[model samples]
Target: MNATAQPLVRFRGVGKSYDGVTPVVEGLDLDIQEGEFLSLLGPSGSGKTTCLMMLAGFESPSKGEIWLGDTLLNTTPPHKRNIGMVFQNYALFPHMSVAENVAYPLTVRRVDRAAKAEAVKRALDMVRMNEFADRLPKSLSGGQQQRIALARALVFNPRLVLMDEPLGALDKRLREHMQIELKDLHRTLGLTFVYVTHDQSEALTMSDRVAVFDNGRIQQIDRVDSLYETPSNGVVANFVGDNNVFVGRLISVQDGRAEVGLPDGERIFGQMVGAARVGDTVRACVRPERMTLCTRSGFDGGTPSLNTMHARTAGTLYFGDHVRVRFAVNQQEGGFVKVPLDDESLTEWSAGDELMLKFDERHLRIFA
Candidate 1:
């Protein structure tokens, strides 16, 4: 968001191609700031990994150029880049203990014994692994091993750190715990982090900004809250979170709003931008949590409401902290409403009941 300062890493029209047939990444332009945590999120074959590999010097750009601070990095080798990397498998040396593993990078650069030991100890303590410094990786838990790997990556105090699905191997609970720990570490170290992952929740939980990639291109990049609430297109809407999609056609445009007719016998109005006209096909995306369930007592026929949909409850799922109500929206089309368990009215609602779904106009996103 700071436009005046130069970025720590900049990619200007960067691209990659394997056989010179299809570019793995086409025309990528990004600026990653210092001391920020960013995530590249997408499904498999989306080119997120390809971009990370290019940045790490494992691969070269077929076209365009990459900049790290003041130096252009397209021709730089991996050893000269001074960037640390962490892989999904932890990548620890089996024969080495924790301290030794953390010391490998410093030893490779020919640092003296005293400096290497001090750096290793500081890195291990940063990740809370200094107590287990002498233990082999095989003797530690998955989370502990990951900590050792992180210490190894940070022991050299590199300016940038690239992580490829680094938390994928751990269990869910440990993964969540590490997410907080990693964010705190990044703050304390004040280093730039480029993380790659397919998990939307993980990205939303940890990233300062996220780049959503699809089909070998960057679809959208923004703060996590903006990306979830106002997705630029349908692909980003469905991929970033659980959305109830309503396919519609633009019927009219007035006062910066477009009227859309949904297939579920609902006519709605939503905000739109860029090259949309009457009779053009479009889509409306609404998040489940943004919907309000209206019972018969509170139901009103006429109001300033823009959209309404009818549904019959098919089932209810209790998630301990929240409740998920599944219903048939229109014929074969389905919908779900997620509500917190603290809502008192939901206690009276049961399966097979009729309900009206209402949503705020500000939360409705239209894509054409």
Candidate 2:
């Protein structure tokens, strides 16, 4: 996102508490750019849903302010906020036909018959559900019901939408299909979306930027690529993707890199993440896919900046696209390397075989 982009929604020093004792959302300061799909992702009870509720005016902030453009939303009611909302349960009125359900928002605002009919048709057409307009919510499949719910949310042509795990009720395949559909719909509508979900893959698949929450606060907020490639903290790193971490003591820091001394008396260089001084404890983190296996002789004259460690293969697990090779390094277990299925190394190694595991210095992230 551009630095000067105007925010469609802003949470400035916002905090929410149930009993005025513990904050469920604490001091949140975030900006959602207009027309961007931003996801609030984390595990259950992480306060992502609370943030969405606050933005939609269903819940008020305990302290500070929530703003939509230049309007203060603290005193506004949900119906007067002009924000569309989709919930996990598909929240459609079972007694109403699909068309009527989609038109309910327009009906509440007293739109004329002709205008409401036209708007309903257009919204249903956008979700490709025009053919099922007469079907009741109970008569449709789970995926179809979700489509109607989405159509209803879009029928009023609101500038912003808040979705709280809208696809959580579908099966795996249908959920995946709806993810693509939602992305396309967001693109075609060009409306700002604030989505909340616990699924990491769903967040990565559909978000322009993801804010990871834990303990009622955002751990990191960045583009999907940046969150996965360079997490700001150990919590964000472990929550976003698979990682292998090794605890060590900081030995030295120079330039943009630092040397960490492992328990086995070996030192390795990596990019520093946070404030660290000599003699401080730190963790060296690397992704399994970033490490490669090679014979000792093959690594003798390899890249000068690469780090190498001696390891013996313990076992291997086959995933369709890749193979996970577990190994023991420096008498410690839990170290593994991932090899692509097409790589010859998958068939060339056996249990108890010794090899060198090599990773580039730049790929190693040091967290203090």
Candidate 3:
């Protein structure tokens, strides 16, 4: 992002409501920078897809304004907005050959024959689908079909590209392969890309920034590392990634840190996310990977500012690269600690064993 350039797209108090009563998207004020890969991420029916549709001009905003560069887009038709859209279903022409499908955008715009052919060839080559140009849509694999859709979207060289779960139909390996390709193409072409997906991993993999949406609103928007590491509230923390939440009351607060009392009467300390006085209810949020685990022999783990708990091991699930160990802290269950395969747990630990779990105060996030 540059220091002081105008945003490529802006939404100011923008809202959408089909019934003129309830809003699917309400009071959305967002900015999309030029040449950045931004992803709108959330769970189903969280207004992410509706926001994308509004920006693509498929759905109109019932209130407020949308701007592309300097022009207001309230009355602009879909084609006149000059935005390329790639959908979840690919939306390809099944009867057309690959080359013909890629050239459809050019045909609609009435580009000259020679220029349209050259553009179609370049777009197909860019997606590595030029060799399959003569094949019908059904003959290609899911990944190849996705590539053709991408080429068609890129053929006319639109101002911005919008993708709504474009890789949702492919297998896991193929989807990962396409993620890398899309990221590479974004870097090579230096064009603005706005993507929508419910997959947080995909958003983190491809986006320079992510807008996390929930209940018809944006909870937070920030860089991936910042959003994951320092979430603004409990909603953002629990939604963006794997988080273990402990309900507790504020026993005391000192210098932006809080001493919390859990249900079991144990006291622990963590960084307070916001201002809270004594005796206020709060939550302790911790990522599984941020915790440290040790056997009974190796832990004296209690201190004034550090958090330590006695947990009895229940079971372990292997994930090839990492192992997730589930345990019960006192009578409560659903606590997980992730460790690498080479950790001592593979050979030295088993179910029904007592382990001490400790974490630094910096890794524990407190929210009210």
Candidate 4:
């Protein structure tokens, strides 16, 4: 990390409310590094968009303050924030060609004619849309239109850029392709990006850090890998990925492990990741890929160090590259285990087969 990577944006105890009641964002405290790509990710009405709107100066905070470097932006107007913005709908002018759309912001700021043309050309080339510069937005594909929108946002060379579900309108494949392009662009531009999205995969794929929000509050903020491996709570764990949960009560704790007793008399040991105490009600999370179908006795210590339970194979669903194995355990609601299609463990496995559901203990996460 360089010394120049100081925080470019800070939200200190920031909050927002519509009618002086029921705040949309409550007590938000975050520091965005100078060029880091940070994302506000959550479901609809989770305050993710509200946070971005506040930062963009489109909405006011009911309490606390927002800081850009050393300047307080509470009274600053949208254009005065000097931040670029991209909306979900692209928001390009219908009659404007790609070049004109890209140059709009610069024109509004009274940029010189020669400089505006040069900047617009550079921005279009950056987005790989220079060839379509003469085409109107309606004449371009969805992805092309989105590229124009992105170009417009960058043409001004703003220090910070805010994107609100910018790829939401594109198809799934195009969205994924754009995610790679945007991530590469972020690295090359070295501009601070404040991305807001409800898609967990989108956030995980593009963000250097992700802040998970729910109920108008930030539940957890961490790197993508860390957030998936050790979630702060059940809500975050369940929200981020495909997770299998087990409801149980902690019976004992020792050596950083918790012995949890499930609905049945079966007791399984799990690594305590979240807040869990003996005799406390808790939920355990395990990723599907970490689980395996155990039928042969040849496996003794191959599994991860965390939670294991006895389960019977109930059914299976084939998904081309992988298969989902559904099973039942101790008369309790059970979950699925996803494995590669060519795994040898599935050779003899069939529906109704009795087997031990194997999962790494280290991957087991307990949340209270």
Clashing pairs in 1: none
Prediction 3 global C-alpha lDDT: 0.89
Find the 10 residues in a row with the least total lDDT in model 2.
Answer: 295-304
Counting clashing residue pairs in each candidate, in order, gives 0, 0, 0, 5
Best by lDDT: 2
lDDT of 3 by residue, 249-317 (tens): 899887877888988888778889877777888889999999878888987756666688777888889
**Model 3, which residues run further than 4 Å from truth?**
275-277, 302-304, 331-333
TM-score of each: 0.96, 0.95, 0.96, 0.95
- Error (Å) of candidate 1 at residue 320 is 2.2
For candidate 3, the 10 contiguous residues with the lowest summed lDDT are 326-335
Per-residue lDDT for 243-336 in model 1, tens only?
8777778988877677888665578877774567888888777899988787756778645654677777778789888998877776336778
Pitting candidate 2 against candidate 4, the one with the higher TM-score is: 2
How good is model 3 by TM-score?
A: 0.96
Candidate 2: the clashing residue pairs are none
Relative to the true structure, how large is the alpha-carbon lDDT of every model? 0.88, 0.90, 0.89, 0.87
Task: Please give, for residues 119-179, the per-residue lDDT of candidate 2 as tens digits.
Answer: 9999999999999999889999999998898889988989799999999989999999999
In terms of lDDT, the poorest run of 10 residues in model 1 is 301-310
